[model samples]
Target: MIRGMAHHVGIYTRQSEQRASKSEASTETQWDDCVSGLPHWGLEPQHIERYEDLGISAFKDVDRPDYRRLLADAGAGRINVIVVHYMSRFSRRTAQETYDDLSPLLRNGVRLISVGEGREFHANNLFALFELLFKLQASHEESLNKSLAVRAAKDLEARLGGYTGKAPFGFTLVRETRRTDSGKPVSVKILTPDTEHEAPIVRRIAELADNWITENDPTGSVWKIARTLEKEGHKTRGQRMAKARGDARWDDKTVKRVLADPRIAGFDVESVYGTRKDGTRSTTVAEYRLVRRADGSPVQRYTPIIPAEQWYWIQGWLSDRHPGGNPHWDGKPSGLLSAMKLLFCECGATMTHGGSGFKKHYRCRRRAIKPGQHEGEVTIGAKGIEQHLARRIFAVMRAADDESALAVLAEAANRYAVQRERTVALEVTQERDRLLSERARLRRSREAHHADRERVMLKGGFVDDFARESWGETEQALAERMRSIDARIAEIGDSKAVGLPYEVWLTADTDPTGPGSWWDSADFQTKRAFFRLFFDRVSVSKARRWAGRGFPVETRVTIEWAGGVDLSDRPMVGVA
Candidate 1:
């Protein structure tokens, strides 16, 4: 404000962190102080603009919107004076950054004022300018010291296995109160599983991810995983608590980021800086790297949902699936069996996506010179056929999980154990669990063999004949062991035992969506992959009429189920 002159004044206020009680007195107090002190300067403000940014830090990394707008207004001469309660309120960034922001206002002849600091600084005031720079330097140092103290405290808490920050997905914070040295009660929070709801979601996601690597089931996509979660009515951590920012629902990138977090494996993280190609430490910024010991092994603080091996592999998998890399699944549904080219017409022509929206269907384009040869073109409603296939696949999965079906023979051995093995001539203890347990043990053992390969690569990427011969022999032993396990697995569900059991890919029963409920929750890519597992090809006859809603899909779609052995060719056990 200038004596006996009217000026356009701008007031700016900000709050770094929101209060838990929902009261925002900090910004209001600053506004009140700035407004009350205006009369002391003997200035009448004709035009006024108030700028504010809440829950944003005045740092290099964070973008402050209102702050930027205020700067622009000052530069354009819209503000004759800019008022703040304190110098730090304008910025706590480094001296250089603080100078850059303030220089524009001073150059434009805008008077700068800090109501609390009792300092008057402008372009003409050289001593005051240096004084302000020194103040900015002090402010930055103070912020840096505070940040370091917070990090040190967090490190100490982590060492004591004390949980800090909001509990991530699949976990809940359990509070326990204890008396401190001075006899004051202090509440401590422990990260614990949300067993009934959240924990199982994580295991289910793990099972889906594990399928591609272990069962050779299908390539899983984070997009599809997100879609499945959406369909199953699973709210994100933010949406559940209702303090969330950004996405309103689950998304592919969000899913990937959540899975990549080390917290899922019960580990905390420390900020790690990257090194340049010349081997010098770069000053870009520190990234959150999973906390590891001096020996380079991960450290765990809580019970982990994933085994260390599986979790590490998942990290590798996600890295491969990053943008512009080789993805497990491209996050598109690819339209039923179209990607596989398994849907065919009666005349043997391949079917493809046609029509639009509700009228959308799979149509076989008429081909060949003679029109009669490609007569009665097949067109099946895509949604109806897809829904029907979903039911059939889930029904097969349902049969596998049914305990009653496993009583005489366990085609359902993986689901429910029928102590009786139909193919076993003599009594045997190796049921599905034992067989699977052994297979898992063999796989773990097989991982050790990879060290031999790694050693060769490190030693100039050449495998000598002698080393190859030794490795071959070692692999043969493991292969032979694996063959025995496979043979036992083959015997688990012989034709004489019962109908075929569709191996549950994702452990259906334990899922919150319930037994065999994955079909309803699956994304396009996932459903398409499962379709290939159960079907050789699906053919459709010519539609007699437009098979609209409520039409029976079975009458048009014919399925050829994939199997190791044709059921019709085998004999039953209980023949008189």
Candidate 2:
């Protein structure tokens, strides 16, 4: 019989638990918590056998053989051994080994007492089974608790947009700043690091890989690249040489890793976890990092580290090298019809392609020649319209070169300025009342006040209602004065100064014979662009008979630039 127990007992519990504190309540039947003072309950002093009395002078004397021999004697009903707790004195490497070792003692008459647990080892089959179940439950509970804690941590990280798992090369987790803008005072929150820092080495690696691919270097595999990096004094994340294997300085795996890593280019990497053939975990890339704007909007980040124009030239060169002509259009070719796409008819129909003889034209797809319900389709060739319009514009520009046109422009500019000044001078005295009232209302609305209105009025006060009433009369007077001066200037200049291109009037006045040719000198894109910019649409019909005489090969070409004008009753010329 055990006499006095130690003050505190050591109950070896599962890995999940921490040692109980002194303030924790001690239990008599639960061996899960270690406690002592067992003999103090009721045992007599004579019944207690100290370590010396039991032939064990020191704790070390209680070896395995000693315990085994004690168990054998107990099995023969020769002795009983007492323990403060079941786990206190029972020590083995594993539960299975401990159970095997204790089997002999269980087969004997040794009734073991766990004073703390009030348990007696009666060598019963049910008792041994119960112990095994208890240990298994303890292990399962410990695993579940650990899994829950880890899950909670990962969820928190995702919510805060923090990195949760392993760090990618060239990136280190760093704390992000959070601020509170309370009225009383600002506050800051400090938390774990998560953001990746941009590394220049990533860019260097990509540039190197791109160069290798372009040059078609035989020795420039990923392994070679890593070796070169190491030779150049580069280090890994651990800041040491990556141990070289075989004849290669760096392995193939290392080089491939560097080339394929988008993070090397300083982008947030995207990857998915995968399992390898060897049943080991691995990673597969989904996409690379994107360049973002200041507000995190994506935009173009790289130009391939190659010149665009040069790249196109090389592609064409390669195509030609293969004995076939390049089938692609050089996107930068020059064109006169660049603005054609913006041209459309007021009727909201796109111009359709049409040509007569050799001349190409763009005409309204919906137009009909006749006004009544019987009106049929209209058509126009592109060449006829371009030539006619170009001639008319050339005429107007040339006419403007004369002294008479300049005189007219100068006279208009001067007269308008004088009229504008006089109107302001006469109205200033009464203009301030309304202006001030408007300003006050604008201020009350908390709207920003601008000085543009006041500045313009101060420079030239606006015309009042009374002045406005007579403004038309004053404008007419100014025009007559300018016209009279212009006519005098015209007398000194040639008649061509006032008349538009002599050809323009001829086209407007006389009818021509057949469709014209224009597309010979222009490509498809140029012709299309011209049609879009020069004319809204053209409407044409085969010569019609009115009163039994055929109307002069009549057509209408609608101009788009400088405000549209329609040239009607025009002739279409047939190309030889």
Candidate 3:
């Protein structure tokens, strides 16, 4: 029954070689073995016998171009294309490649069969097209879904109060598992690397820094200390080559990187990369610009493998010798006032420090006297203005009626919520309309292409022109849909909706000086929340003093509340 009717069937795939007592196998080999002796659904025993005569050869590690060429030559005369699996076994990972390779074979009477899936030579043209589209869509969706899940997981992990990337150099990841009573699953813990051995080296480095400064080198730096350590045969952690930079040996930079490493102190760090408004990527520094822990005290900050006292000693000694005397202390205004460059000025001009010597003040950044502009120039000295304004505002708010003020805030919040809901509804409607239009356009293009193809084949019309027109129409539809989606997102406006504005009016009747300072007397969390809500900036301005005389500016003054009157226009006296 062996014959030459079927010439050859080439199986090409990528598979690793396995070493086993029963059999040495590749994926293709395993698949072939499974299908070889099995009865074909349509192929008679004689056809199987002829297949053996034609010869079955499996080609491993074959690339896509080689496989396509082989398939093309085989389809011209004798042979069929049967893949083990559709996507995993045979994929170029490009939609165009799939279309080009498969379309030609299909048109030239070549057949495709997935032996593993038991899908033989499917004869129905429409069914085959649908199957191919379904598979392609599934593959596309799988890749996109995987990408989104990974991004979301990475973001969540970053926010989980720990390191989001590689475990610090000192640590190693180890898999752990355990069993409970009755052999059930138990708990797991990631063991931190032991730093007991490394802690001594850190202390030594700090001590060296302190010693170098005390020796009065004046220009003594971290580099001098590192070189001194290297000469003393002090090796780095783990018998590994000492961390070096160029010919200088392990320097301060190396020591610093190691000492500042959070892993050594049993803490974690997470750095996030994000895109800026200018369409560029940026990496944020450590979170918590300045941390104050729950205990209302400054954080017990991470150490740089150096004892606190030694580091302090080194810093103190360096400061004493350095000429500039801590360059940061230049008597310039800093903190909340320094950061508020945009808020104070109406014409968007930055103010300057004006006071003589260390007693600084802020002056108006104006362009002389401008036409139609009234106010001559409001000059507010730094400390007096800041403290007076803060105390006055706090006193006013504390004296206000709590229930009435909160009711106003609640109404404003409700209005904002309603507006946001309407915006969301509008976006959904617009998106649905866009999708419906795209679907219609796609359907029309498909129908037109089918009709045009028929005309070219049956009526002997210009094939090139018809084909070009059909492709153009399809491309147009695709472009339109893409544009619509992009436009829809834009119409949705900014991603994060601004929260509603809630106002609280502060009165002068029940002032803090009247009974108790409301701010100091309020609950801790309430005080914190209030500060976060209304107050954007708080600058402790210096009190005005001149020629050894303190002006009696009505210290602890009381406000006369004119019973829900508009006293905003009235002249107000100063408070202590």
lDDT of 3 by residue, 79-156 (tens): 454434434344424445455556666665555555555664433586776676566556555656766786775554
Tens digit of lDDT per residue, candidate 1, span 173-243? Answer: 88766555567665667788778767787877766676754643335668778887888888777676666
Clashes of each: 0, 14, 4
Extract clashing residue pairs from model 3: 383-541, 383-542, 396-506, 397-506
Instruction: Name the 10 consecutive residues with the lowest summed lDDT in model 2.
Output: 50-59
Alpha-carbon local distance difference test for all models: 0.66, 0.40, 0.44
Model 2 lDDT tens row, 318-373? 21221112345232222222223432333544455545457555555665543332
- TM-score for every candidate vs. truth? 0.44, 0.27, 0.29
**Model 3 global lDDT (CA atoms, 0 to 1):** 0.44
> Where in model 3 is the C-alpha error above 4 Å?
1-132, 140-165, 168-264, 267-354, 357-359, 362-380, 388-576
**Cα-based lDDT at residue 180, candidate 3:** 44
Give the CA lDDT, 0 to 100, for residue 123 in model 3.
34
User: Which candidate should be chosen as best, given TM-score against the real structure?
Assistant: 1
